[model samples]
Target: MTRITSERHTDILNGYKSGGSRFNEWSREMLGDFTLLKWGWGALSMRWDIDDRFIMPDGVMFGGHIASVADHVAGLVAMTVLTDSKERFRTSRLETNYFRPLTAPVAMIEAKVTNASKTLIHVEADFVNGDEKLAVRINAVQVRRMTG
Candidate 1:
């Protein structure tokens, strides 16, 4: 299977530009169909409709899913920002904090790059619902892959 992790920056950036509209068919499949809400030079917002599979037994969204959303969306932002540099990246670290229960049926994620260097990049995200209630905060570090 062709994984998003293995794809080039141009392909991933194009996928993000179309925002779940089949610009990059692999990204739509890999992300399980995330809807692109917004995009800029170094940032992006995406959303996912909460389903029963994303809910925990306590009737809240699963924390792992929240983290995955942040990571995947943030990674896309990083890749888009670095597309011109011909660089690939991998998440070196990821952290998420839950502020309250995610009761909404949809998750709106906004991610942006905090800083970047030749070797490392930092990104953060706010996971909110339709009403703008904060559900989680995510911080991630991406390391540029040095390819021969």
Candidate 2:
């Protein structure tokens, strides 16, 4: 397995901060992050403020946003692992479970690559609120896009 270099990690973080990439722009526009805490090998973490757009009718965060974050972070981790610039990753499946309503002003997402193969990458992400309460659990499978 190839290891992720520090420069690549920096590029990934900068991509997110600057919204230089299409994925980064979409994620930032949808998920609102105040800080990207970590971008290590096969792992990414972020602290985000609750976007009012993500609020549900009940006045709490929508479950769909949590799922989106999990999937998006998985793709970001896959991007870090990719070697060629032409290569890309897409989510094949995503499963999310909501344990509690997230009403906090801020939340954290910790995403890690659990397993990776030539064709598929498995990832898991957890969403926790400011009080350390587990709000959502996310699992995803990312597939490497085939190219000619």
Q: How does candidate 2 score on lDDT?
A: 0.74
The deviation in Å at residue 1 for candidate 2 is 2.3
| Residue 93 in model 1: lDDT | 95
lDDT of 1 by residue, 1-148 (tens): 2223234665556566665445446544543456777666667788866666667788887777677767787687777567444467899999999998775477788888898776888998888876788888889999987555
| Model 2, span 26-136: residue lDDT tens | 666777654666677778788878877788878788777777677767777666666655566788999988998876489888888888788888988888987899888
**Residue-level lDDT for 54 in candidate 2:** 84
Candidate lDDT values, in order: 0.72, 0.74
Report, for all candidates in order, the number of backbone clashes.
0, 0
Off by over 4 Å in 1: 1-10, 16-33
Index of the highest-TM-score prediction: 2
Residue pair clashes in candidate 1: none
TM-score of each: 0.78, 0.83
